[model samples]
Target: MKLNHSVTGQDQGLPIMLVHGLFGQGRNLGAIARRLSEQRRVILVDQRNHGDSPHDPDHSYAAMAGDLAEVIGAFGGRVDLAGHSMGGKAAMHLALTQPELIRKLAVMDIAPVAYAHSQNHLVDAMAAMDLQGVVRRSEADRRLSEHIHDTGLRAFLLQSLDLKSDPPRWRLNLPALRDWMDRTTGWPEGLPKGIFDGPALFMAGAESDYVDDAGEAAIREYFPQARLLRIKHAGHWMHADAPEAVAETLSAFMGGG
Candidate 1:
């Protein structure tokens, strides 16, 4: 499927693609995309079932990677890819399977291992809501807060809630995403090991346990040339917590420094 995307910057140099985390659209990373687009082209993609991308029942790593591959094939022969959370897993899979299409890989705050914790409640809360009667964003948010107490997370997730639509529908395919929570949260099985040996950067959040000492073993096994860096004072949402630092690190990693 042709994924929805935004392109910025010049046609010169190796282009960079920014893949947002779960429940995010391409425009969610507009700040980071604009910052990175200064010297080179930047492509912000909405993964399948998120944003304006097509919704499919298959929401696995392989399928997401295939979507990224298609984007790379269309935008450039190869691209420098950076992804956050769920998007990071897709980047890793694409880099591993189609190494030639990715010049460099950057995975932010997530490893290739399956996460023990599940975000099923987040999905379920979204899926449970019927936004047809919701007249205002605040009302929707207030109702959502009954299920999801976190204000910041509700704000982020609500970006995909199309309040401007006639009936105020959710831009995200909540049912399809909710159904594949297991595969979305965990790393896919049956993939070959350490297929990507190119320069790799794993930017972790100092405040997040997504990348721990226990996870390093698996990181090394999959990406032998990978280097890990921590964004101080940031959590899983490092870009939001430390936008400047994240952008700076991204620029340096992509050799724009």
Candidate 2:
């Protein structure tokens, strides 16, 4: 599947591709992408079934990784890759299966191991939302609030809701995401734990348990050269929680600083 992407900076050096997490569009990483684009080419892509990309039923990492491979191939077949959450898994899978396609890798707030948690509840909330006659975002927010209490998360999720359409609708494939929640939250079974011996950085949020000791060990097992860093005063959404710090850390790492 061809992803909808936006490029920044000049055609110099290996381009860096930024992939966003679940329910997020490529623009979610706009701050980091813009910062990194100052020195290198930055490509922000919307994975399949999200943003303006084509919607498909399969949301497996293998399929997501394959989609990313196609995008990377278009940009000289190699790239410095970074992904958050689900996107992180996709990037890791790509680096493991097609090591040559990645020059350097950075995974945000995630590990190579499968996670037990699922984001299906959020999908259900969105699916249950009443978009009928929802002429404004506040209406949708009010309806979603019945199920989701987090105001911030509700806003974030609403970013995918298009109010300009004839009837307000979500850009995300809610059905597919809900159906494939299990696969999305898991690592592919039976696949050999291949290694990616490239420069890899696993940036974890200091307040987030997404990358714990076990997660760090798993990361090193797959990427021996992986360096782990923890950003202060941040949670799972570390980039948004600490944009400058995350951007600086990524900039220095990608520049071999």
Candidate 3:
């Protein structure tokens, strides 16, 4: 599917594509994109089933990676790809399956291994939300609060709420996400055995357990040239917690330095 995307910066060398995580849109990485765009073109992509992208029943990493491949080919044959969380996994899968499409790969706060955590609760909360007579984001927030206590996370999810659409509705495909929860948090079986020997960056948040020892091992197994780094005082969403650091580090990784 042709995913929704926005491009900035000059048509210089290979573009840098930024992909967001679950429950996030491309604009979530706007800060990083802005910094990188100064040196090269940046493609902010709304992965399928999120943002303005077309939603499909399949949300597997392979499918997601395929969607990204389409976007990359449309912009240019090759790109320097960076993705956070779910987007990071998709980026890795693309690089593994089709290395020619990627000039460099950056995986932020994620590993190529399956995670035990389940985001079904968030999907359930969003699915159970009563949009009836709710005209304001606050009202929706108030209802979602019963299930989700994290104020920041609730606010983040609320970004996808379409308030102008008559009675209002979430732009996310909650059912598809919930149904495909396992695949969303899993690494596809029988992946390509070969490694992506291109320049790779595996950045983890110091406070985040997303990329643990096992994750680091997996990184080296698949990307021998991978450079590992950790952002201080940042959690899983390092881009938000330390936008400047994330942006600067990513800019340098993509050769913006």
For each candidate, what TM-score against the reference? 0.97, 0.97, 0.97
Candidate achieving higher lDDT, 1 or 2: 2
Give one digit per residue, the lDDT tens place, for model 2 in 1-257: 99999999767889999999999999999999888988999999999989989999998899999999999999999999999999999999899898999989999999988789999999999988889899888888899999999999999999999999978889999999998988888877655454677789999999999998889888877788889999999899988899999999899988821
Give me the runs in candidate 3 sitting further than 4 Å from their true place: none
Winner on TM-score between 2 and 3 is 3
Ranking by TM-score: 3, 2, 1
Q: How much does candidate 3 score in TM-score?
A: 0.97
When summed lDDT is taken over every stretch of 10 residues in candidate 1, the lowest stretch is 248-257
- Model 3 lDDT tens row, 1-257: 99999999877889999999999999999999989989999999999899999889889888999999999889767899999999999999999999999989998999989999999999999989889888888998999999899999999999999998988888899989998888889888877744688899988999999998998888888788899999999999999999999999998888852
Off by over 4 Å in 1: none
Query: Model 2 reaches what TM-score against the true structure?
Result: 0.97
Model 2 ranges off by over 4 Å = none
